[model samples]
Target: MTTLLPNYLGGRWQTGTGAGSALHDPVSGQALVRVDATGLDLPAGFDFARRQGSAALQSMTYGARAALLVQIAQTLQKHRDAYYEIATANSGTVRNDSAVDIDGAIFTLGQYARWGAALGETRALRDGDAVKLDKDGLFQSQHLQVPRTGLALFINAFNFPAWGLWEKAAPALLSGMAVVVKPATATAWLTQRMVQDVVDAGILPPGALSVICGSAAGLLDNLQPFDVLSFTGSADTAALIRSHPAIARQSVRANIEADSLNSALLLPDAAPGTPAFDLLVREVVREMSVKSGQKCTAIRRIFVPQAVYGAAADAIATKLAKISTGNPRNEAVRMGALVSREQYQSVQQGLQALSTVTQVLYDGRAQPLIDADPAISACHAPVLLGARDADGAQAVHDLEIFGPVATLLPYRDLAHAQALAERGQGSLVASLYGDDAQMLADSARALARSHGRVHVVTPAVAQVHTGHGNVMPMSLHGGPGRAGGGAELGGLRALDFYHQRAAVQASPEVLQALGL
Candidate 1:
């Protein structure tokens, strides 16, 4: 029998009332554990965080909180190997992919911890200098940032169980807010284990962090005006969260990072055999294979100049053909299975939709598996498709495959490429490859209006530049329109989401006394 994973609530781990749902290993198709939260006391959990956890965190100075964050990072580092083991079995991710999620989480926490030292021990963060409100200058006003006296609720996606949780938890904790996490059911083992490790260490005050492993049936209904929800998932789910009566009426704060149809454009100057051409092909293949193209920021659409469309497509196909798919435990396997059978079927449905307007360049169904049975395992072959008509294939931009798949489109010129990219509505990221400075600059400026980050890769920086799919902690990772217009992880600016800004309209003497 597999172990039953309990939910953390009210300062203790509780075995809730239910039969529990079984979680499986994607590579072997075997049950590993059962998790359930049917009878979790939702209201009491939030109340404990608000009335007790919030108080304990608020009593500490920003520097003290930063110290706690650093301790958590250190603690996780000691137990990092255990997490990678679970991720490979449960998430079907290769070792490199697990490092991206597990190591990336620890690195992000460390960065935030060091960044907090600069904030000092102040409770109230002064936003700006006092402004003269009157001619005499006796009356002045200054903006002050104070921690919210509430809790933070996080709903994470399955692709990144560890990083998804810590990325939001780090900032919320640093800003003096308690956290309640709801990880995706398909891959909650890693998340639940990480949270358990932190809670068991006793480094954080009781109720500072809690996890709900199974159903979140009544979680959102208990939210208050002061509470904040940071969600990373489908856009349809984000819309539902926004329209919830409790969320809409109480004016509860919510930040959404939704899946988008991100694109990469190969400039006209990046002709065949050039460095820029090779870079674009290599980047696209990497994005498609890494994590099996399950990333929200993965390149879903590839735009190439009309002159070399066939060459670009052939190059990407050749690289993708070289990837070996199978059990993550195999040292020779380059790509692994999907997180679950449901995700595999979802990827199939996307392929069906795109087939109506595109032709297959490469089909995964024909690929050979290594060290795993293709019949029972959840592995999927990498697929590449070409638009039958670049100007009319709306599904290419509107539908999200969410797997190892990408659609190639041909563009006439720079303006045409920019227009084709904008058709995505908006994207979390867009990459442009070229040797011409003017073309790269022009496309980047136009793409910036729609994409959160525009990565420009020229022949000069191709060797040293960070790849297109990476989401750095120092940069902004949100986008406008279909990408969900919510900014996250923008250096120190991320703290604003967890703090309340208030203007102190008072005399200079009064402001000084208030520590402005």
Candidate 2:
């Protein structure tokens, strides 16, 4: 019997007349469980989070809240396997992939706790007595990060159900604001279980964490001035939500990290059989297969020097050909399926769009290698596309196939390569390979507009592995323009997504009484 996930609201369990939601295993295409989301007490939940949750969380000092975060992470670690078991249903992610999302999220929160403790009190700015202006010492200025007086609405992506929720929740909670996590409907099972574990663990006060099942139809209707909405998804949805009158009229805090055509550039010095070429080839293949290329930070674009274009293209194709695409449960399968039918269609459309700009090197459509379970874990095998004529075409810059699909674009020189890479408008990250300091610095600036995180791939640096698909807890996950300007996992900057900062001034005597 599957354990049905219950609604976590006001520190108790309850479900009303609303219809239940069904979840299925991607590998077996079998029913996992039915979640009760119908007739949820949303209004009451919101009131509790604001009137009760916010106050309870805010009453604690930053240190206390950070301690609580560590405690919740510990509890989550105890039930880690349970989360991995449940996650396999919605997305056919392999054990390692699921573990990285689940355990990595817990570690991210734990790390955030340490960061919060190091940053100290929320009231960061304090005046020493008073700075005398005109020798009177009557004036003073103060700055602090006060909790926004309402709930934080976190709408997560389906690609990473656990990590997505905790990355935003950890920072918001540490900053003394209550959170309402709304995972994508496709993978809410793990979210519900984790929330239940959090409640059972008793690490948080009532109303600190609330879970909403079903849809977010009315989530933005009555938003308050202090309310925050952070979204991670497609660009179209981001635009629609950003334009909502309530978002602007009430001045809500809205952050977005949409998928973008992120690219990687190989330096002119890199050639086939050389160290740089080896690094570049490995990166493109790894990003394409990691999480089956469902990550927002995955390398969707590849720019190589024209001198080694043929070798790079062949290398990528050979790697893709050798990959085994099937159910995650199968040890032989290296790539898993998309989340659902909708995601499969989205990935297909992206591939079609790429065909318009560049030539498909290994077409998944022409010779499809279907998954073991045709329905659940069904997605195309890894496909590589490259520009037919680099001088006459500008396709790789604008085209983005968001799956186990990659496009290779060739460039004549470093300057031309940077120009082609920058044409993507903006990206989440870009990898540059070379040992020359001057070339590396130049490429970094050229890719400045497009890349948020720039990774330097060289022979000296390739020995140790730094997780690429996963964003670091201290760095930003978002890029400019299409990449969704708002950032995630940027340490204290993540808090800025929830709080409203203002500089206040008053008389020194008055400020002294107010506590300088």
Candidate 3:
């Protein structure tokens, strides 16, 4: 019998009924553990978090909460090696990719801790300076942001089980909100273990942090008006979440990150054999191979000057040809398998849809796997496709394979490239590679209307610029339209999602006495 992973809820650990769903090793297809949330008292668990958990956390000043975050970060660092083991067995990720998730989570927590400590003993945030109502300074109006007396429910995606949890949780927790995490079932082992370690350490108040590892069927249904929901998943699921009574009728706060077909463009100035061109090729390959190209911010569309179309294609393919995909445990493998057989099938179907309008530039589907059985393991090689006519390839802009797949396309000039890039409707990011400062600035402004972030890579910052698809905590992470119209993780700006903003009208003396 597979060992059942317990769900932490209502200040205690409990097991769900039945055999539960088995979590399999993506490399060897071996069942490692089971998880289930059937028959758990979700309503009571949510009530516990709202009352006891909220009170405990809200009682502390921002400095005290910052101390708690530091302790949590240290605890996770202590068990870092164990987490790497789980990532290999369950997530089928290489050491570098695992660090992107596990280490990224810890770093985000620490960054938030440092920011929170700077906030000092303030319980509420003042929006801006007070204003006089009648220009006499006798009466004033002030806007204040206070923590909502409720819990935060996070529904995360499978690709980033570690970072997805903390990136959202860190901000919410720092704002004095208790957190309930529902990690994707396929890669829930690492998340569960981290939570277990933190809970056992007894560093946090009981009911402050909880994890429900299986079906999230009833989780949203138990939310109250003051509660907040943060989700990272498919657009279809995001739609369902938005229409749910808890969000639409009860007026609960929600932040969603959904489907994005991010793009990378080579400007007219970055011709073949130039440093900017080389930088573009390196970034494309890195984005496609990292995390098996399963990131929400990964580049899906590649646009380049029509003159250097063939050269760009050849360069990118040459680099991708060297990446070996197989079992992550093997020392020689550069990339690993998809999260599960279901995701593998999804990628295959997406490739077929894209093939109707594009030709294969570099096909790795026939490449042999290393140290694994093809009949069972969920491994897949990176593939590059090309479309001669960018405007006619509607499927290329419409579909996101959620795997190691990207389509290369051509554009006439900068204007043409910007138009083609906007075909994605809206995206999390759009990166421009070039040497001309004015050209990069003009292109970034044009793309900014539709993209949440505009990443410009010039020769000056090529060595230091963070790679595309990396969601840094210092910048905004969500996008406008098809990317879910939500915003998260722009320094202290993220706290706005968990706080309630209200205007208080009072006398100058009363406002001064209130201390913002």
Instruction: Give the top-scoring candidate (lDDT).
Output: 3
Query: In model 2, which range of ten residues has the least summed lDDT?
Result: 122-131
lDDT of 1 by residue, 331-410 (tens): 99999989998899899999999899999998867978988887778899899999847889999989989999999999
lDDT tens digits, residue span 305-347, model 3: 8889899999999999999999999999999989998899999
- Cα lDDT computed for each candidate against the true fold: 0.90, 0.77, 0.92
Best by TM-score: 3
Query: Residue-wise lDDT of candidate 2 within 224-271, one digit each (tens)?
Result: 878898999888899998999868677788888886877778887777
Q: TM-score for every candidate vs. truth? A: 0.98, 0.92, 0.99
Q: Between 1 and 2, whose lDDT is larger? A: 1
| Per-prediction tally of clashes | 0, 3, 0
lDDT of 1: 0.90
Error of 2 at 277 (Å): 1.7
TM-score of 3: 0.99
CA-RMSD of model 1: 1.1
Cα error of candidate 2 at position 200, Å: 1.3
Worst 10 residues of 1 by lDDT: 507-516
lDDT over C-alpha atoms for residue 460 of model 2: 81
